[model samples]
Target: MHTLIASPFLDDHLLLRPGSTQGLRIGERRFKELAAANSPCPPWLVDAVGRRWPDLQLAGRRVDEVVLVRQASPFGYGRASYELNLGCNYDCEHCYLALKKFDGLPWPDRKRLLHVMRDAGVLWLQLTGGEPLIDKLFPDVYRLAYELGMMISVSSNGSRLPNRSILDLLTTLRPYRLTISVYGATAESYDSLTRRPGSFAKFQRGLLAAHEAGLPLNLNLIVTQHNAHEHDAMIDMADRLGLPHHVFSNMSPTIYGGAESLPAQSREYLRKRKPFTGCNAGHTFFHVDPHGQASICKVGRDPQIPLLAEGVDGLARLRSIADKLLLRQGGCTGCGLQGTCGTCMPLVTLYRKANAPLASYCQHGPDRRDQQRR
Candidate 1:
C-alpha cells in the first residue's frame, strides 16, 4: 500500500490519504520537488506528516518508491467520473439511464483510460454506473485506480456490500467514500421501487456489513411517489449510522432526452434550485461514459470526445465545446427569464427536446414554492 498522495489540485497542491479526509496543503516548490521521480523523501515532509505514513520516517526512501506523486497537466482537471459499465442488477422505474445495456472497454483499454485520466491530472475519480459494484472489472478497476493514487468513490445500490470478497476488497484498499442510494425505509416499499424481490433484505445486510467493517459511507435518500411517505424514516435510519445523507426528490429525464423517468417524481417534494451560476464542468471536472466518451458533465454528453481514441489531448477542445453548448442559441434564445433560470442550458435543452411539461423545470409553469413539503 502507498503511504500518501502528493498532487496538484488545480492551481494549488494537496497532500491527502487514500481512505481518510485528513490532508495538508503544500506550496508549489515543495510539490514540484516531491513530484520528481528520483528525489529522496524530504525530511520536512516526513517530520510534518510522518505519523500518517510511519514508514516514510524510517531513514532513506526514494520518493517514487513509497509516495504516489501525480504529474501536472495542461488540462488542469482535478476531478473526473467514469461509468465502469451501464449494466445493473436492479431495474428501477425512475432510472435516468434509459438503456441499461451491459458494455465497456476490455481490461487493457480500461487500464489505458485510467492512465490517461491520471496524466490529465484527475486526482479525484468517481466510479458509477447502472450499478458499478456489479461490473465484472470492478475489483481490478478499483485496485488500479487506487494504486495510481486517485481518491476513488463508488456509487452503488448497496446490495453487494455484504459479499465477503467485496467487503474484503473495500476493507483492504478502502475508498474515499461509498455513496449508496436508499430507495425506501421498508422492504415492501423498497422491493416495489426496485422491482426486485429480496433487494431490500440484501440492502439491509449490506449496510450492516459496511458499518461493521468500519468503511466510510454516506446515503442518498431517493424520494419518488412510491417512497415519499417514508422520507423521514430514511433520514432516521441514516442518522442511526452516524453518516451524512442527502435527499434527491427530483426524477430527471433519461440521458437520451427521453421523459419516461419523470413520471416517478414526487411532485410535493419538488422545489426550486439555486440560480444557474456558471460552473467549471469541462475545465476543473469532466465526466466519462461507459464507452470512454468524455463530456463536459453528465447532463451534457453530446459533442463528447472519444478518450480511447484521442486520449488526453482531446480534452483541449472541451472548454470551447462547453462554451458553445451553454449558449442560449436554440429554443432558449429569446426567453426573457434566461438570466434567472434555475437550470443550466444543457439540462434545459434536454427537457425541451423531450417536450417535457413546463411544470417540471420551468419556473413560470407553477408555484412550487407554495407546495414546499420539507
Candidate 2:
C-alpha cells in the first residue's frame, strides 16, 4: 500500500497520508520537479518520508513507491461527495432525504462515474448514501475510489459497522474518517427515533466494534424531540468513547422539497447560524447523486449536469451554473438583510420551494425577539 500521495488539489498541490489526516502543501515547481524524476527521490522529501513514516524503509525507493503523484488536471475540483444509493435500513423521521429510494447506476456506469470523478481532479472524496454500507456495491465502489487515490470519508448511521465483511473491508482499505450519526443514548429513544425495533442494538454493537478496531471515527449527535432528553448523555457517550462529536439540532426539508423532517426539529436547541461568507461549491467542488447527476451542491439541484449522458465534458458548464445559483434571487428579491443572512441562498431557496414557514430558516424568523420583550 502507498503511504503518501502527491496530487493536484484544485489550483493547489498537496501531499497527503492515506487513512490519516496528515498533509503537507508542496510548491508547484517542486512538485513538477519531483514528478520529472524517475527514482531515488529528493533529500527533503526523503527526509520527510523518514520523519513522517518511521515504520517504512528509506532505501533506494522510487517516488512512486512511497508517494503516488497525480498529474495536473485542467478542471479545478479538489473535493466531491457521491451518494452511492438512497436505500437505508432505519426510518428516521429526521432524515433530510424524506423519500429514500434504493436505486443507483449499474456496475458499469458506477465504475465510469468513479473514473469521471478521478479525472475531475477530486482528491478528497466523500462516499455517502441513505446508508452507504448497506449498498450491495459499497465495498466495490469504496475499493475503486480508494485505488483511484482519493482520500475518503464516510457518513453513516453505524448500523453496519459490526458486519464482519464490512469491518474487514474497512480495516483493510481504511477510510480517512467514519462519521456516524448517533440518534439517542438509550435503546428506547434510539429505536423510537429510528422507528425500527432492535436498531439501537445494532447501532451499539457497530459502535463498539468500530471503536475496538481503532479506526478513526467521528460522531454526529442528531438532536430531535425523541432524543433531546438524552442530549447530555449522548455527549457523555462520545466522550467515553474518546471520539470527536458534533451536534446537529436543526433539521432541513428534504432534497425534493418535502417538509416531513421539519416536525422532528428540537426548537430549544435551535440557534442562529453564522452568516454565509460565500462558498466555492461548483468552482472548487461539486456533489453527485447516485444516478450520476452532478450539481453545484446538494442543496442546489436544479439544472443538473447528467454526467453519464453528457460525460466529463459536461463539467465544463458547472462553474457557470454555480455562479448563477449562488446569486440570491427569486423569493429573496428585494431582501435587505442579505448581508446578515444565516443560511446560504441555495438552502433558503429549498425552504421557499417547500413553501415552508420563513421562520424555519430566515434570520427574521418568529424565534428572534427583542431583548427587552424577553
User: Which residue ranges in model 1 land beyond 4 Å of their true spot?
Assistant: 37-40, 50-62, 366-374
Candidate 1 per-residue lDDT over residues 1-374, each given as its tens digit: 78688888988988888888778888888888887658667787777677765644634777776678777778899999999998989989899898899998899999999999998999999999989989989999999999998999999999999889899999999899998999999999999999999999999999889989998999999999999999999999999989899999877888999988888889999877777878899988999998999999999999999999999999999999999888876755756666677878898888887888877777753333443321
Residue lDDT tens for model 2, 1-374: 66677888866788887787777778798788777878777787877766776775656788776777787778878889999999899999988887899998899999999999888889889999999999999999999988888999999999999999999998888889999999999999999999999999999999999999988899999999899999999999999999999999988889988888888888888768888878989998999999999999888888899999888789999999988888888756556666777888888877877787777788664334342245
Q: What are the models' TM-scores? A: 0.93, 0.95
With a 3 Å backbone cut-off (N, CA, C), the pairs that clash in candidate 1 are none
Candidate 1 positional error at 130, Å: 1.0
Stretches of candidate 2 exceeding 4 Å from the true structure: 365-374
Would you give me the overall lDDT of model 1? 0.87
Candidate number achieving the greatest TM-score relative to the actual structure: 2
